[model samples]
Target: MRDLKPWLALIFKRPGRLVMGGALIMATLLSGIGLLAVSGWFITETALVGMLLAAGVAATINLYVPGGAIRFFAVSRTVFRYLERVYNHDTVLRLLTDIRVALFQSLASASRRHRRQLTGAEWLSRLTSDVDALDTLYLRLIAPTALAALVTALVVALTAALFDIKTATLVGLVLLVAFLIATIGTYLRTRHLAARQSDCQESLRTAVIEYIEGFAELTAAGRTGKHAAWLMRQAHQVTSEQAQADTLAGWHLAGSHLLINLSAVLTLWAGFALFRAGVVSGPVLVLLPIALLGLAEIYAMLPDAFGKLGATAASASRLNRDCQAEEPARDTGAQGLPANAALFATNLAVKHPGHAPLFTHFELEVNAGERVGILGYSGSGKSTLADVFSGLLPAAHGNLATRDLVYLTQKTVLFEDTLRANLLLGAPNASETELWRILEVVELADRFAPEPDQLDTWLGSSGSRLSGGEARRVALARVLLNPAPVVILDEPFTGLDAGTRARIAKRMDLLLEGKTVISLAHGPDALPGTDRVIHLPG
Candidate 1:
């Protein structure tokens, strides 16, 4: 409900668009009646030459009037769609921003121990998908739907006036009945749609993000076949569900058209019979069918829109559910840490799924000048611990807190961006010396890749073209350049050769000597043997 307010405000803010849209609908309805009126005259008027000619002229005008009315309606819809985009986008973006912020805090709030229950995809999902899920409401449910309903009602009323009061009333009654039925049917299925759509979308998002993020791991770690196969399976599942949703929506729309068509036919037949019986006039008879218009079809459409909205609502509800899965950890990590230190995490415990505990009651304290190595057996929870201490995982049970922590993962996540642009994330206004200094840390100072024109070299996604060791060093360089108090590494030297690792290690030790460090060990020889080895009690 709280999230609904901003989207509602979006509909209200563009008064000009709303008015234009309303007028278009009103005019189109008027045009529908004019068409029936003129067509009826053409049908009924006989060989009174003057009456016939007048009728012909009126017919021509009415034919053109409907087109003009449609043009206005189309133009109005276009303008409305534009405003809808702005307002809807803004509202959803705002919600997403707020959600991400909350999740960020939640990540901090959950003690460091909670980090094991999360994946890169899960975190990214919270940041991107959950917010995106709410967008379904804006795009599918709100604007077009409201406009469709308002216009349909207005057109029905105007058509009633053009025909006899009785005929008008009948037409309205028929449209109302059809719409009510359609809406009811749609309403019945809406909950199903919501649940299905939310699940499918979440799965799709999780699969895609995980595939992208773990592609390298899957390749280097030999999980590619398994991972790719799993992705195919997930994709198929999402597609199947989406196809079902679309099929249902399409059927609903078609049924609506049938209902609308039926009402139009009934109104025309009844009206014409009355006119022949000398109970009504030509204009009324013609206008009755014409008035049973494009708008009337909206009665049928309302259900589908509502159904779609229900789906979006389902998605939003699920996302919110994810948010409230465990209430926001009320503890703020910002309390006792001095801002000047490189990084800090206190009493951080990380746990994993299908486990009693990753590390029971973990405690980590890194001060101004120290390098701490986090050690654990294979699956013993080194990376999980690293993630916890760095504020990536929020649910770890024990007093989790960090100050100025920067995480350098084994896989260097570089966009298809330039050398300078990538570095800009750390320090946007870095000078030449700064860049050179950063390059020095990674031992890439004098060696330049000539493939890219200059500092604006576009290293492809995940720094693919570069060797794994080079990419790892590049990420390390980025961390070195950032003026942060703490540097956290999760097997940052994974793919590096022994010499390269040793060289980079020496430079890092000197540069990070005064800063707190937490590096997760991969092999027994991983890292330069830090000040402390955190053990995982199996």
Candidate 2:
């Protein structure tokens, strides 16, 4: 339960809503109990009066008050139940919005290596399914459990006041035992199964996403059937785990029902014995049994709540771990970069985990308005050096300072949005004229010339609607739009044809004029207008 403290804090951010929702839930449940008790007493008392009347005895009975109370209880229960659903769902949705934003921000700030450890599918699971699981924490676990406790207390007090300490004690003990048994037993029985099911579900999601994204490659390789079979196997595993969890939950629910019914029967039998001995009244006897019966609704939901506890806790734990920020060593003496310098590094070291240092004792200095090209083999640390320059990766053992820089990686990424929106990511306030200038420079202006929507035309996922060369051009156009002092292009022409590459290189000098540019590629010839070239050892 303590694993939920962070999420609980989010809920409490809107205290008024939380309290109001809980209050409504309490009212709804209490109204249901009141309706049941009142109906039972009214029917019993009316029958007694009828019996006396049939024996030729005059019996006075007031049906107005009890009938009115029943009506009030019924109407209030229905109204409160509806209100609770509406208000609670709205609050949950707001909480989910906050949660998604926070989760994305946290991941965005994480180290590049750490972020890479979580695959696209895993991230989707965390953001969607895991967050959805936390949604049920408040309504299912907290509210129902709290309400059950309150109901138990009220029942015990009522019984003690109307009957005796013995009866109240009996009811309290029965309820306490039943609750512990249901909660503990269900948790123990389904905890492992629930965790397995969660893992299986995540695996299935990952497999499906992979199949969708790689369908073309699979078909081309004649392995589509193999991929389909793999997906089926993952699906079967998820289904099997789900079946086991459901079976356990069903058994626990059945057991909970049996216990509640047994408690009611015992209470009724004891009440009848006391009534015959003149220790209990008919109305009180009937009320006691019916009140216990009212609790059946509360206990009925316990099995599911406890059964899901394991999965919820696992999800919470995973989120907590992923959201945790790495404590980078603070360099107290670190100073800002000089105004005239684009970037400076001295004795810099960078390495991936469990691997030899990629760069050691690396020293670099780039003045303002310099065009530098880094030529290295495939396994060389050219891209990593670019990452260090852009502050995406930290150096292990040196002082590094750089002005803000725009980076264009080898893979061009574009969201499913209008061309205008994608460009706005670089310069939010840039005018349409500015957008056209950059697009024309990147050789993409003619691509949109035939479309009526022009800049407003939607770019499909990852710019799927565009050709590979066109997507790279759009990405470069976005980078060119950024108002940064330094520009880092890492293999920007990897997928383009030779003619397209030459054309883009010839235009690079004009587009990146008066900026400190560091272009990383396989050879110095890959980037034109290179004033100097540095080659790294393999």
Candidate 3:
């Protein structure tokens, strides 16, 4: 139980507005219930008037007034019903969005570390299904349930005042018992159902994402049957969970009907005896149980009453659990880039759960304006070293420092935007003079190739629309635009031909002047001017 106090506390932060909205909804529900009670009054009053001769026309006029009251209630309900839908839906979606944003922020720290442990399905569950399920909280559970119970209680009070005020008072006591039995019983029983439903959604998401992402590979390797069998298993598990929840819910539903039936019967027995005693008229007797019938219908929908509490609990649990990985920082919350930097790392080490140490007491230093080459066989800790140096790695034990560093991995990254957008990402407000100056250094001197506004041309997937060497150089150009004090490159020669490679090597010296540079190289022979070269033992 992580605790849901903070999340529930959000409900009261907008107290005046929430209460006002709730009050309006309550007013609407009461109007509808009042129409029911007033119609019952109309029936009873008309019946009683029929037995008297001289009272006929005057009684007809009296009945018509309550009918007019009933009509007014109907018109008001219809008017508010339209407004309620718009406002309620907006409130539900806003709540859902808030839940989603909170979950994202909570998971932000842990997600980067346990990427594999947090599956697509679990994410989808929280983002889509779990949060969506919370709509039941405000819509079905809180507003409608609160309104129904309150109005029904009022009707019960009205019934009691009818046939001897004392008898009506007893019915009020019975209404209390009826409400307690229905509301509390359903709450204690079905509250856990939301959390269980959230879990079910998570499981379904995982199975479905796994089934979809592996579809092509499974088809290629002819393993469709195996995947299908796994999906079937998950489906069965989901069904089993559903059946269990429904079984519990079935008990509550049965208990609700039983309580309502008992309340109605009790009201009848109590009210009927008074009718025969001349203590109450036939009209009062007939309407006493009808008012209880009106309340009985409302109490039967108790599941809708307490549903939001369960949803809030479920969402709060999901968010708190996901955010457990977020570590409170002891260091000041600043990641400033060092200028004119000399990189230093001494006794650096990092180990993973199932793997041996990537670096055990490793050490390296790069002097300003010096180019260092890192050559190693695959799996010899090349990219891992770059990650550690660039503040992206969590160290087991190590010291790593640089004032400012521009690091690029072997895998080229492109955004879905224009060429200028990707380049300006590092320094958003760079001038045209600064942009053109760096572009010429990378030997991409042309202002435009196919478009009049070359820099402004719409690029796809981190400039995948550019050729391989062009994309590499363009990515490099973006790094240049930042003008960081340190530049680190991992396998930048990949996907380039010999001419392109030579051109990049030529461009690197011109573009990376006065920067502390490190390159994880494929071959030492390719980068001749690299001042310090360290080769991993082959």
Estimate TM-scores for all models: 0.63, 0.77, 0.70
Which runs of model 3 end up more than 4 angstroms from their true locations? 1-3, 10-17, 53-58, 144-173, 190-201, 212-237, 261-292, 296-301, 304-319, 328-344, 364-382, 389-392, 400-538
Best by the TM-score measure: 2
Clashing pairs in 2: none
RMSD of each: 7.7, 5.1, 6.0
lDDT of 1 by residue, 1-538 (tens): 3434543454455566455544544444444444444454444433233476767754322446545555665665566556545655665565455555655565555444354455667666655655565534443455445655565576567656554566556666766666655565666665576567666767777887777877888799998898888878878877787677666666666676676777678777777777788876665565556545555444544656666655555544544444443443424255665555444445555565555766655555565667777666677777676665665555446565566667886557876787777777677778977887878877776555444455676678877767777677677777777777777888878777788778878887887767777778755477764877765554
For all candidates, the clash counts are: 10, 0, 9
lDDT of 3: 0.68
Off by over 4 Å in 1: 1-140, 160-170, 193-285, 296-300, 307-314, 322-332, 337-350, 356-364, 369-381, 394-397, 416-437, 445-449, 453-456, 497-514, 520-538
What TM-score does candidate 2 reach? Answer: 0.77
Q: Rank the candidates by TM-score, best first.
A: 2, 3, 1
Q: How do the residues 1-538 of candidate 3 rate in per-residue lDDT, one tens digit apiece?
A: 2356555455445566556667767667766667776777678777667756455554443756787898999998887777777776776676666666665665655524454457766766666665565544566666656766677667666666666566556666666666665666656766787567656657767778877888998999998998798778878877776576566655665666665566667767777887777777665566556656666556656644553345457766775666556453211112332454477766778565477887788877677788899999888888877866765555567666665778887778878888888889767889877777777876675744457777888777767677877777778778777778878888876667777678768877876777778888768755525888999755
Candidate 2, 239-340: lDDT as tens digits: 887888888888877776677777788788888889999998788789888988888898888888888888887888888887766654323122656667
Instruction: Give the better candidate number (1 or 3) by lDDT.
Output: 3
Q: What lDDT score is found at residue 442 in candidate 1?
A: 77
